[model samples]
Target: MKIIQNFTDYHEKTPLALSIGMFDGVHLGHQSIIRKLNAISEKKNLESAVLTFWPHPRTIFNPNDDLKLLNTLDEKTYLLQKNGIRHLFLKEFDEAFRNLNGEEFVRQILVKKLNVKHLIVGYDHTFGKNKSGDFSLLRKMSDECGFKVEQVEAVDFHEKHISSTQIRNALAVGNVKEANEMLGYIYSVSGKVIDGKKIGRTIGYPTANISSDPLKLLPKKGAYIVEVFVKNRKYKGMLSIGTNPTVNGNSLSTEVYILDFNEDIYGEEISVNFRDFLHEEIKFENIEKLIERLDEDKKLTDNFIF
Candidate 1:
């Protein structure tokens, strides 16, 4: 997919069938809109396009909150590409852009910049100046502006609507199964393997410490069964997201122990896909107890694989 970083960079000849949102996690609900977008794009012979924001609007309004996002730019790009979008307009959200009203956003970004011939949005979607736009406003604008607009209804799972916020809440509680079910895929994070205290080596577990994006949301602090990807290979593993309380550490860390494998992966890039929540991180009474718990973890992880 072609990524258009700025409004000036947009130069598409074919008018676009577009959707706009943060698309955080690009969960099932977002996918419903995307699927409709692609169908309409193909049927109407327009370019499939998406206009997503960066740094999130919430991050801007609540600067002190350090609001975490579900997908990084790179991850979002890949997911959108897989969903069959042709053009991705990644607009930077700032105070000035936030000031645009619903009509202004339709005129400027949708009509002027993207030349959007068709627009698809989620059921609860809102845009422009305090989110004053909804399907009603969009339909009225479409009638006046000479473009087409569609609102895809929410995708309901087990009587609850699938949404990004719901998925984030699930992960926050270490409910990977629910999150992944709503996401329609494994929820994963990518980061650089950094040097740690080398404490795992002495215990014979030798973990690869991960330095993930600060803006990216992390799962609840606990042990988990995970799939690790490194050097273009996938491996089963157990991951920990918590402070090393047994070692008198107070800072939270993310590290994974690759099953039946050991190598120098420091400074390498790795991805971890959470599969199942294992146990809450425990502060063992002694080193021996910690080692014993780790052994049990390894067995459970191994059995999970087999």
Candidate 2:
């Protein structure tokens, strides 16, 4: 997909069919809207495009919240390209851009900038200052603005609506299965292997310390069955996200022990895909007890599949 970073940088040859949102996780609901957008674009012979924000608006408005994101910019770009989106207008969400009100946003951005001929939006999507823009506003101005607006009903699983917030909540509590179901893909984290205390090596379960994105949302502090991708190869593993209390450590760590694998992969970038939650992190009485628990975790991990 052609990624347009600034609103002024978007120069389209044909009228565009577009949807605007932060599209944080680009969960199943977001995918549904994108699919509909592509269909409309194809039928109208217009370019399928997405207008998204960077550095997430929440991080700006809620500066002290330390907002965590599901997919980083690179990951979101890859996913959008995989979904066959033709264009991506990724604009910075700074104070000046955030001040654009409903009508101004429509005239200056949707109509003037992107030449959007059709708009597909999630049922509850809202934009502009104080989020005053909604489906009703779009429909009311469609005729004057010379564009069509579509509001897709929320995609639900088991009668519950799928949303980025829902997915994030699931991950926050180590509900990987629920999160993945809503995401329509495995929930994964990527990082470079870093040096650690090397405590696991002494217990026959050497682990690779992961230095993941600080802004990425981490699953609950626990042990989980996971697949680690290293050098483009996937290996089954048991992953731990915790502060090593047994060793009097306080720093949170993400470490994975790849089953039946042994190699020095320090400084290499890797991805860890969570498949299942195994157990919660605990404060073992001693190193021997922790090792014993890990052995059991390995057996349980071996039988896990998702």
TM-scores for all predictions? 0.97, 0.98
Q: What lDDT tens digits, residue by residue, belong to model 2 across residues 1-306?
A: 888888575566569999988888888999999999989988999889999998888878888987899998899998988887999999999777899988889888899888889999998989989987888899998899999999999999878899888999999999999999999999999999999999989889899999999989999999999999999998999999999899988999999999989999999999999899988889999988998999899999888764
Judged by whole-model lDDT over C-alpha atoms, candidate 1 comes out at 0.89
Estimate, for each residue in 281-303, the C-alpha lDDT of model 1 and write its tens digit.
89999999999999999989888
**Cα error of candidate 1 at position 156, Å:** 1.7
Return the number of clashes found in candidate 2.
Answer: 0
Off by over 4 Å in 1: none
Q: Which candidate is the best by TM-score?
A: 2
Per-candidate Cα lDDT values, in order, are 0.89, 0.91
Worst 10 residues of 1 by lDDT: 5-14
Candidate RMSDs in Å, in order, are 1.3, 1.0
Q: For model 1, how big is the CA root-mean-square deviation?
A: 1.3
